[model samples]
Target: MKKIAMTVFLSTAMILTLPISSHAGHANHQPQESKELLYQDMLMLFLLPHIDQAVHDFYAKQLTASPVVYPYQVEVKKAERVGGSRSFHFLITLETTPVVGPHIPVGTDRLRFEIDPTLPGQVKLIQFEHLKSHELPPRWRHMIRRPEAIR
Candidate 1:
């Protein structure tokens, strides 16, 4: 009878503590809005420093025979949450220069950033696809061939 009473009392105490502990645990948790804002700030800051390096590396890797240097720009095309993961897509353009050859025409690529859920505010580059300048829209294609056309 004593053992049964002790077990019942312990179970009751454990159950009573669960709610209090859970509430306390959640007390310091930030709302999703603030968490997302933090994530965005982290993402922007992380990408800004690495964009130039990534562009240079891509060119060096893709064109091993002749290392070419071209003015490059990265434009964030979109950022969206798909399923449980956040994704950032960027249009990377390496503008044509006076010395650009037929083989190394104006370069364009789609850079994709897949958020690493485990790392919270970090991202992994999932794709870096080379896009032909001709594949773009007519106006964009023209702009690639003649950059001054738009300006």
Candidate 2:
């Protein structure tokens, strides 16, 4: 009787634990790599059509005014694909200017840019509400307008 009772108890315990172990195994499963590729595709589609002459014109003006620091390094921070479209948030790090004159010093600026699939390829500058005191050049300010407001 004692032996039978012990065996029954062990069997019930094993049965209860089996499902929990299986669930943990499922959690370790790898996500598909294709999801990332699909996201890139969506981003390209949304931006290519929305980026227009106005956007280019704005960048050109900035370049003309500040040829020394015209080009910016764009880093894509996050990208997501939803409903056949891609959205992206990126960071732009302005190249530091070389120190000039006796008292002036070179400075660096970092800006965040957001691109929605609705306006693909076109990036809009978001005002850093937290850093309201940071001063950016006029050209940079003009370039920060939304796609619809560019013209």
Candidate 3:
């Protein structure tokens, strides 16, 4: 929980500071973001809340004796602004492996977000795809069935 809180705080700070950072070159110059850059930024903001959950889910499925580690990677494959609002569409790929499975899991999830720049706290997830491409191992399956097995 603390990790997630810290991640959210950091991501929020980074996003909020991007405009300032980009315009730091000259006092009179204001940075203008290209459409692509804006889209990428919006896509990143959209994915921020999900990163910790993805990591947690990835670690929970592992049945190995080795210590669990951050096992997932998220990549933004494509991003586009929708209409004129601060809404965006995204295509993201998440790659990881199940804790006990021998196979690698790769999932492509589509996401859409509506961001109100003026009211940053009102950012909303318009759409989400919970993508999972691999079956759990026997041990994990058993643990999943018995909720108490989860610590």
How many clashing pairs in candidate 1?
0
Off by over 4 Å in 2: 1-67, 70-105, 128-151
Candidate 3: where are CA atoms >4 Å away? 1-46, 50-72, 82-108, 119-122, 146-151
The better candidate by TM-score, 1 or 2, is: 1
> Residue-wise lDDT of candidate 3 within 68-115, one digit each (tens)?
222233455444454556555323443322233343332334444555
The runs of at least 3 residues in candidate 1 whose Cα sits more than 4 Å from the true structure, single-residue gaps closed, are 1-45, 62-72, 83-106, 133-151
Alpha-carbon local distance difference test for all models: 0.48, 0.38, 0.47
Quote model 2's TM-score.
0.24
lDDT of 1 at 147: 42
Tell me which of candidates 1 and 2 scores higher on lDDT. 1
Q: What ranking of all candidate models by lDDT puts the best one first?
A: 1, 3, 2
Cα-lDDT of candidate 2? 0.38
**TM per prediction:** 0.35, 0.24, 0.35
**How many clashes show up per model?**
0, 3, 1
How large an RMSD does model 3 have? 21.5
Candidate 2 lDDT over residue span 61-88, tens digit each: 3332221222212123444443453424
